[model samples]
Target: MEPHLPTTIQISAPQHAANNPYRVIEGEEVLSVAFREFVLTAVAAGWKEPEVALTLADIADDYVMALARRAAAN
Candidate 1:
């Protein structure tokens, strides 16, 4: 059987208001490059597609938190 490789992934980048934390914009392609790079690295390391998906979902919250921290620092 052939391997089930993924052809696409969605990455979003939000625009946040500096004055108000509640004001935000969405639907931006901000992290497409980073996301694709990470996925390619994982695949090259022999991570199957399903495992990659499940692991990504599992660490999503932690990843978002890390991103938030990075944003706060900038």
Candidate 2:
């Protein structure tokens, strides 16, 4: 199998820190770029079909959201 290349998602820090404390501290850390990387890696590793890639991407999206929520709660 070929190597899986990682992908990055750049999430900039949101403004209005007083309104969103999590955004002020965690910032882009709340967004799971690693999850996006995992999905891309899976796609590069023989999972070339569109449906499979989309499924992985969805999973990655869920992961990112979950991470953000967790970060916010803390």
Candidate 3:
């Protein structure tokens, strides 16, 4: 099956910021929104930009590898 990336994404946030903090991220927006959040949060905690980027790339590579392994196994 081909991957589908939506041009537009809809995110419904919790009514209260203190609770129900997680929102569902779909399609390519997950790459943008989630990646941005991770980078910003990591940088805020004093992580260097290059290291953060490399970490994200490594995570993405691992995810794709896992998916490929799953498909091959099936």
Q: Relative to the true structure, how large is the alpha-carbon lDDT of every model?
A: 0.68, 0.67, 0.67
Q: Which is the leading candidate under TM-score? A: 3
Query: Candidate 1 residues 1-74, lDDT tens each?
Result: 45666565545445665665544323233565656677786777688877887888779978999999999999
TM-score of 1: 0.44
Runs in model 1 deviating more than 4 A are 1-28, 62-74
**Top lDDT hit:** 1
Native-referenced Cα lDDT, model 3: 0.67
lDDT per residue for candidate 2 within 32-59, as digits (tens), equals 5645565566666766667676887798
Once fitted onto the true fold, the runs of candidate 2 whose alpha carbons sit more than 4 angstroms away are: 1-48
| Shift in Å, residue 13, candidate 3 | 10
Candidate 2 clash pair list: none
Judged by whole-model lDDT over C-alpha atoms, candidate 2 comes out at: 0.67
lDDT (tens digit, per residue) of candidate 3 on 1-74: 34443333334444444443343223345557756776776776678989999988899899999999999999
**Per-model TM-score on C-alpha atoms:** 0.44, 0.37, 0.59
Q: Which residue ranges in model 3 land beyond 4 Å of their true spot? A: 1-26
